[model samples]
Target: MEVMQYAEDALTINLGNEVDEKINRQLVILKAAIEKLEIEGITDIVLSYTSLIVYFDVQKTNIEKLKESLSTLDLSDLTDSTYSYKVIKIPVCYGGKFGPDLDSFKADGLEPEDVIARHSEKEYLVYMLGFMPGFPFLGGLDESLYKARLDSPRTKIPAGSVGIGGQQTGMYPFDSPGGWNLLGRTPIPLYDSSRESAILYEAGDRIIYTSIDEDEYYRIQEAYEKGQYTVDIEYRGEENGA
Candidate 1:
C-alpha cells in the first residue's frame, strides 16, 4: 500500500492501481480500521476503486502524525472473508421500450433474449460508484455480451437504465446523457432524495439481475412510486450495482 498527501489536510491510501475484489476488500477494511482508531482530526473518509482519501482537520493533527498512525495499521490479515458483503436483486425488463438498444448485441451474433439471460446469470461485483450519484460501476459482465458505446450518447437516459460499455455494465441512477449501450431498465429507484440514505448500493456489494415482463415492470414501478414497495436486502454474503 502507498500513502500520499492528497491535499493540505487530506491523505490518499492507495492499495492497487487496478480494480479488483481484493483491492476493494482492503479498502473497506482499512476504512473500518481507520474509523475504529478514532483518529482525531479525521473529518471524512472517501472510498474509490482501490484507494481511499482521508480528510482531516489540521487543528488536531498533522500529515506526519496521521501518516505515523496509518503506518501501524494491521492489514496483513485482511483475507477473503474478513469483510462482509451484500447481494442485491435488481429486476429488469429487457427489450422493446425498456431496452431500445438491446438489438445492439446482434452485431456480436447474440439474440436479445440470450443476452438478457446471460447478463442475469452471474452475480456482478460492485467495484465503485461513479459517473453520477448512486451510479454503481459493476464488474463480472458476460464477455459474449460485450458491446461498444453508441455512435452518439443519448441526451437523457432514464434512471435505472442498465447499459453496457466495453467490458463493464452499469445502470444510470439518474436521467442523464450517457453513451453506454442500454439493454434494459429496472423499476427500482437507485437514488431517492427523500430517503435517509439516498444511495442504495455501495462498493464491495454484489448484484444479480432478474428478468421481468412489461406487466411486472409496471407493477413494480407503480408500487415503488407509491412508496408501497420496499426492496429486500440480505445480510452478509449477499448483493451489487447502480
Candidate 2:
C-alpha cells in the first residue's frame, strides 16, 4: 500500500491500481480498521475502487501522527474475519414500455428472455455510489449483454430505471439525465429523501436482480408508494466471494 498527502488534512491510501475483488477487499478492511481507531481528527472516510481517502481535522491530528498510526495496522488480522454483506434483490420488468431499448439487443440476435436471464443470473458487486445519490456503480455484468451507452444522453431518466452502459449495469436512483441504455426499471426506491439515511446500498454490498412481470411490477410499485412493500434482502455472511 502507498500513502500520499491528498489535501491539507486528508490522506489517500492506494491499495492497488486495479479494480479487482482482492484490492477492494483490502480497501474495505483498511477502511474498517481506520474507523475502528476512532481517530480523533477523522471526519470522513471515502472509498473508491482501489483506494481510500481519509479526511481529518487538522486541529486534532497531524499528517505525521496519522501516518504513524496507520503504519502499524496489520492487514492480516482481518483475514479470518467475515464481513456480513447484504444481498439486495431488486425486482425489474424488462422490455416493452419500461425498456425502450430492447430492440437494441435484439439487433444483436439476443432474445428478450435471454437478455433478462443473462442480466439477472449473477450477483453484482457495488463498487461505489456516485454520479448521483444512491446510484450504485455495480460490477459483474454478463459480457454478452454488454452494450455501449447512447450517443446522446437522455434529458431525464426516471427513478429506478435500470440501464446498461458498456460493461456495467446500474439503476438511476432519481430522475436525472443519463446516457446508459435503458433495459428495464425497478419498483424499489434507491434513494428516499424522507429517510434518515437517504441512500440504500453502499460500497462492498452485493446486489441481485429478480425478474417480474408487468402485473407484479405494478403491484410492487403500488405497495412501495403506499409504504407497504419491504425490499427483499438477505445476509450473505462474511466473504463477498462465492
Candidate 3:
C-alpha cells in the first residue's frame, strides 16, 4: 500500500493497480481500523476499486494526528468478520426490451446465447457500491465480454438497465444517461430510499445472475411491482472476525 498526503486534510491510501481478493480483504480490515478510532472529525471513508480515500475535519483531526492514528493500526492482525454474507441470485432477461444495446452487442460478435452463457457462468463480487445508491460495482467480468462504452451516452437509461463497460458491469438504479453497453435488466429494485435498508446489495456480498426469457421478465416485473417477488439468497461466513 502507498500513502499519499493531500491538502493536509485528507488521506488517500492507494492499493495499487490490480483488482484481487487481497485488496478487498485489506479494505475490510482498514475500514474496521478507522471505525475503531471513533474519531469525531472524520467525515467519510470513500472506497474505490483500489483505494481508500478518508476525508477528515481540519478542526478536529489534523494530518499528523490522523497519520499517527493510522500508524498504530496493525494491519497484519486485521481480518474479515466471521459473519455470513448472503449470495443473492438475481434473475435477468437479456436482450429485447430490457437491453437496448442488443444489436450493438451482436455487432461486436456477441450472440444473445453467448452473452447469457458467459454472463451467468461466473459469480461476481460486489467490490464496492457507488455511482448510484445500491448499485454494486461488480468485478470478475469475463475478459472476452469486455467492451468499451458508447461514444455517445444515452439521454436516458431506464432504471434496472444492466450494462457493461470495459472490465466492469453494473445496473442503473434509476433512470439516467450513461455510456456503458446495455446487456439486460432485472426487475429487482437496486435502490429504494423509503425502505429501512434501501440498498438490496452491499459490498462483500456474492451475486449470481440467473438468465430468464422475456415472458418470465414481465412475469417477474409484475410480481415485483406487487411486492410478490421473494429474493433468494445463500450465506457463506468469513473465517475470521471483522
CA lDDT scores, all candidates in order:
0.85, 0.85, 0.80
Q: Which stretches of candidate 3 lie over 4 Å from their true place?
A: 7-9, 79-84, 240-242
Residue 108 shift from truth in candidate 2, angstroms = 1.7
Name the lDDT value of residue 136 in candidate 2: 85
Q: Please report the TM-score between candidate 2 and the true structure.
A: 0.92
Task: Residues 103-201, candidate 1: write the lDDT tens digits.
Answer: 877878998888988999578888888888888888899889778888899999989999999889999988999999988999998899887778867
Residue-level lDDT of model 3, residues 1-242, one tens digit each, is 57788766889988767777667757756776788788778998877777888899998878888887787776666664453466888888888778877667677687878888998847898888887677778888988788899999999998988889888888899998899989899887777676566876776678888888888988988997887887777878776443
Q: Which pairs clash in model 2?
A: 83-238
- TM-score, model 1 to reference: 0.91
Best by TM-score: 2
Worst 10 residues of 1 by lDDT: 233-242
Model with the higher lDDT, candidate 1 or 3: 1
- Give the poorly placed runs of model 2, Cα more than 4 Å off: 239-242
Give per-residue lDDT, candidate 2, residue 169: 91
Tens digits of lDDT, candidate 2, 26-86: 7777888898888789999888888899999999999999999898887766655777667
